[model samples]
Target: MFAQIRWRLLLSYLTVFTSILVIFAAGVRLLFARSLTQQLTDRLTALGQGAATNAEFDNGRLKVESDFIVQQLIHKNQGLEWFNLNQKSILKQGNIGLNLPLSLSKSPIQFSNKNFNIQAVVVPIISNDNGKIIGYIRVSQSLEEVDETLTKLDLILGSSIIIALIFSGFSGVILTRQAMQPIEESFQRLKQFTADASHELRSPLMAIKSNAAVALKYPEKMRKSDVEKFQAIVSAANQMTHLTEDLLLLARSEKKCDRRENSVNLTAILSNLLSLYQPEATAKEIDLKSETGEDMYLLGNAGQLTRLFANLIENALHYTLSGGTVEVTANLVRSYLIVSVQDTGAGIAPEHIKLVFERFWRADESRSYWKGGSGLGLAIAKTIAQNHGGSITLTSQVGVGSCFTVRLPSVKISDNSQD
Candidate 1:
């Protein structure tokens, strides 16, 4: 359980962190790419304008002046290439070299190859007298610097993400362990208390039973009323025994453990339990009925299911007054088996319905021992349902009765021969 909790915490942290990292990386790449492209385009435009101004029309022949322009066009170790419209190589700057075609009619093209990107611009130069194009200039710039900067940025971002993930993973595991410590301690304490309490209670109960038996041994010397009182003492001790057992069972159920799986016939279990309780219902003048669909099969522990039903039925019997009705019904609903126990008893208040299933929580503080309840019945039933991948819900009104429903995944029979 602790391992599962830790893993879940780690996964949650990683999911959130990775999502933000991905968004940040994408945004940075896009913004940097846009900024670099704009800077390159601006530089190319400036170079093209300067070159156009330096070229002059002298007797119908283009004469390029300006020593600075000539020097820039021939500079070595720089990344710039230039070509004239007549497909003749003009001035070339930088170590990078390129070949030009004479009959070029295409416009400027910007393309990236491998790690280096190139931006080419074509500009037309006009004649001095008319608006006719004398020639065109093409300039290209290399994007090696931008590529290197972006690569460094990517490394920094990746490193930061890795460091953050390591820190978060460590923190998540520590926090998960700390959070579960109290829960583990509580479970241990509860288990030890149940064991010690059960053992302590058994001694007194056995003594009482022994004393009652001894009193009956000298029945001839005792009054009829005295013998009857002793019998009542024995009966009360037995009831206490039952209550202790139920309490222990509830405590064990609360501790998480795998339940044994077996094929359970809901209809059979309900029918048998109902039959066993029929006499009690008749004696109390209450109507008890069972409505079960044919062969409702489920996969769960049979013992837990029996106990679940017993507790619900017993609770219904205890609250319902004489001449009231208690009903038990089971059927298959789609992929689930639904069982409902309803009674015409003093129904739970709307506000208390949610708390009724909590351990040792009783709505009536003045509930008597004669009812033979320890207030753990509903809690046990809930735990059993949950362990079986199911749930229990309650609906009640103050004056009207209450209905407790249990829904569990149903097992499909290979053949529907027996409906």
Candidate 2:
């Protein structure tokens, strides 16, 4: 149970951490790509404008006069090329014609080929007077740099997720162990108490039973009052026997040492349990009913399930008054098998509702002696549900009634059924 809780905590942490990291990584990648693309485009546009402005039409040839400007443009823009309108490259260096368009068009043209990590943008240099096409200035840049940056970002994000998962997993295990330590210690103490209490009660109970038997054997010599006293002793001893049995059951439940898997027909089990409890309900004049779905099978310990339901039903019967109703329903809903026990009894108080499931907790202190309850019923039920990868919850109103619902994952009928 502690391990399960810890795993759930770890998974929750992982989900949240992965979600945030993925969103952040995507955002960063998008911004970086956009910024880089825009910077490249702006630089290309500026160079194209410069080339147009610096063009000088002398006779029939266009001449670029500024040596400093040409050197700056070529050196700074390493991967860009300048080309003429006749599909001829002017700059012979740095892979030129890759950007120059095949068709003569005035509009800016952009193209990319991811195989080579190459991107190209071409713009025509138009004459200012007649708006006629003069020459073309093409700009191209390698996407290798961008790819490298993104790869690094991926590595960083991946490493962070792995590190966080490791740390959280370790922390979750430690925290879970610490949290369960007190509970384990409490259970140990409870076990010792049960053993001691049982041993202490046994001697007195045996003595009483033995004396009662001796008196019965010599009934002729005993007075009527003495017989009556012996009968009372026998009755008390019987009650003590029942109490000891309940205590042992509770102790075994607390230990939770048994874990065997077996296929069990849940519907059949519920039906049988309802049948067994019917007589008790009739004695109290409380209506006990069972509604089970068809062929609801699951893999679990039948003994544990029986104990779980017995505790719940017994508690319900104990609390409920005559003419009240107790209902048990089982059904398969989606992937879960749900079992609900509802009772129209002296409903739990709002304040005591939460504490009712705790060990040795009783809402009605006045009826504690009459009920003959050790107050470990609901706790045992809860433990059983959890052991089966299930959960139990309660809802109650003071004047109305209380409902205890248990939901467990459905299992196949063909699976191992040793439990």
Candidate 3:
């Protein structure tokens, strides 16, 4: 159980940490890309404005002087284009290795060409004399270096996230173990107390029951009131004895041990249990039946498996009304041996179904207690099923009936092995 808890804690920690890393990485990438692009746009806009100054309208036609100012604008990894107001490119400078449309923006506008991996900006030239639009200047630069740097940053961030998650996984395991230590210790102490208390109570309870039985055996020598009182004593002692036995069984079941070496004949076990309960069913006028094939086998402790099914059958019979039916069936479905104890009884309520297997929990507490049930029968049965690498489930309707099904891994037994 603690192992499962530790793994869950580690998985949750890794999930939260990974999400934070991803969000942080995305934010960092966006900010860095925006800053780099802004720097590039600013440089391009400055160059375009400077080059636009040298451009003049001659005879109502735009012309740019190829002087040092325009030449300086066409630096390494940069290009320039001057277009007239008619949106026609008249001059190109340096290596503008992309076929792009003329820029017609009145203000500095930045754009990119994915095919050429380039960033560029356009600025409209205004006449200094009359403040009329005359021409446009476009400046461009390669984005190969910027893209390379971003890619490197992405790689580093991804690697760091992976490393950090690995470290957090280790740290989470240690932290969960430390957190679980006290709870585990407390559980061990409680289990030990139960086992010890149950063991200590057994002697007194048995002695009381036996002495009461001995006293009742000689009814001739005792008053009628004394006889009834002794009978009640015997009954109470029996109930307490059963309760302590159940508690001790549950306490001992917590130990992790292998019980798979013994091969139990499931068919024989069921047949014997049905026979044992046949008298009680007959007394109640209940139609108790069994539908099972021969030679069903499973690997488990026979006594424990017997007790597991006995609890189900007994509980079924206890709740069943006179003239009702209780059926026990066993079959091999695929690799599992399916056993069901179905009873046509006052079925469980939907709301109380989940709490049925909780130790000391009863759907109708007063009635269940009066009926001589310790309320740990189903809980012990569930524990036994789980310990044997099996499971038990219930399906019921309030007005109809209840079916308790047990699924255990089936095993094949040869004739020689059985012999």
Candidate 1 lDDT, 1-419, residue by residue in tens = 35667678779878988899879888988898788777766776677666766666667555555334435544521234344445455555554444545334454466665546666666666666776666665666666776788899888888988898888788877887888789878968877898679878988898998989998899999999999999899888988887788777776665554433456788889998999899999999999988896988877777888999999998888888889999999888998999999998878777888899987788772233235677788989998888788899999887679999999888755532222
User: How many clashing residue pairs appear in each of the predictions shown?
Assistant: 2, 4, 0
Rank the candidate models, highest lDDT first. 3, 1, 2
Query: What ranges in model 3 sit over 4 Å off?
Result: 65-121, 128-148, 211-233, 279-289, 319-327, 342-355, 364-371, 393-403, 415-419
Please give the distance, in angstroms, between residue 105's alpha carbon in candidate 3 and its true position after superposition. 7.8
Selected candidate, larger TM-score, 2 vs 3 = 3
The TM-score values for the models, in the order shown, are: 0.56, 0.54, 0.78
Best by lDDT: 3
Residue pairs whose backbone atoms clash in candidate 1: 78-94, 87-102
Q: How accurate is candidate 1 locally (lDDT)?
A: 0.76
Two-way lDDT contest, 2 vs 3, winner: 3
lDDT of 2 at 273: 83
Candidate 3 C-alpha lDDT tens digits along 167-201: 88888888989998999899899999999999999
Model 2 misses residue 367 by how many Å?
4.6
